[model samples]
Target: MHLLRPLPQYLVSRYHGWVATSYAENSAWYRRLADDGQRPRAMVISCCDSRVHVTSIFGADSGEFFIHRNIANLVPPYAPDGLQHGTSAAVEYAVTALKVAHLIVVGHTSCGGVAGCHAMCSGQAPELEEKSSFVGRWMDILRPGYERVKDLPADQQVAALEREAVLVSIENLMGFPFVKAAVEGEQLSLHGLVHDIRAGTLEQAEDGGRRWTRV
Candidate 1:
């Protein structure tokens, strides 16, 4: 296609380096994964931030987790209106097809997506309010979360909203009929976590997102 171009040289070099080292050492493992197909134990819904590395944080190897990344790591309430739903599709496949035991919604500190939602909600960013802005529309999923933390101090609102994003996503995920059934049947478990990027710490929500504990 005219719109597609060759990969950048840096990325090409990185790919070759990986193939020579990591991939070379794990060739047999890769072959086994390819032959048997992926059997990930958990599905992580994480932010698109480059700083957030789920595998590195968990010390997981390839094929160990089925990961999906999106702005703010937000999942919308179940709405099967016959429209394309990338996040929903990933969740469906992860739960029904892969049968992942855990579905984790991971949020991070100082997330740009969360900031954008904060700005949009506070009427500070008019550009994001446009209907044509994909990032803005996707971030609308976190509006309810923003409402909960809006009353906090100005300096603390963004950070609070970041954790709220994870909680909101976990709540929306259960709105899916299959997800509810899976939980009720004891086939799946849900987790909400927020990562402190600078501190390299993680906190998990307990008691249905009402309390947080270090994990």
Candidate 2:
């Protein structure tokens, strides 16, 4: 806490403004949510990109979607090593506790994390391969995805990997015992999507992942 810096006064004021206006207008719903607890129907795993607003894109309100974010929105295969796993923990809670019916992985264009992984896998980013590189190790989950796209040109490879990231997450999500069970029982459905930043378009992958169609 000592190392933390105070947030800007402008942002603090803006938050207070929203609390007084939007929060006040929706006070009843807010109180109901707080009292009854959240039972979101869907879980969205997305990148920690400021540009990609999951709720805004989905027209979702509070208590509608359980959202978890991480670099490149990648999900690692279930290891269950009795170690701390933030993403996996979120997925477990969403599926078991929240009982979310849909689990969606959202990838995006112009993703810095994906680009970095592409660079690292292509041997263009030696720094990320260092033993002390936490990000590098975290991104190792996507190495299999990189292998699928490694043969393409640099530009195409980045895009391919970006799309592949979504597929990889879907594949990894099945690695979770609970997720796999829910999915097999038809209680949970898995989805993959990509957001085009410049075009402001959203695309959903076909059932077979053969193509992406605008949604």
lDDT of 1 by residue, 6-97 (tens): 99999999999999999999999999999999999999999999999999999999999999999989999999999999999999999999
RMSD of each: 1.2, 1.3
Instruction: Estimate TM-scores for all models.
Output: 0.96, 0.96
lDDT to native, each model: 0.95, 0.95
- The Cα RMSD in angstroms, rounded to one decimal, for candidate 1 relative to the true structure is 1.2
Q: Let me know the TM-score candidate 1 reaches against the reference structure.
A: 0.96
Q: What TM-score quantifies how close candidate 2 is to the native fold?
A: 0.96
Residue 165, candidate 2: alpha-carbon lDDT: 91
**Model 1 spans > 4 angstroms off:** none
User: What's the lDDT for residue 90 in model 1?
Assistant: 98
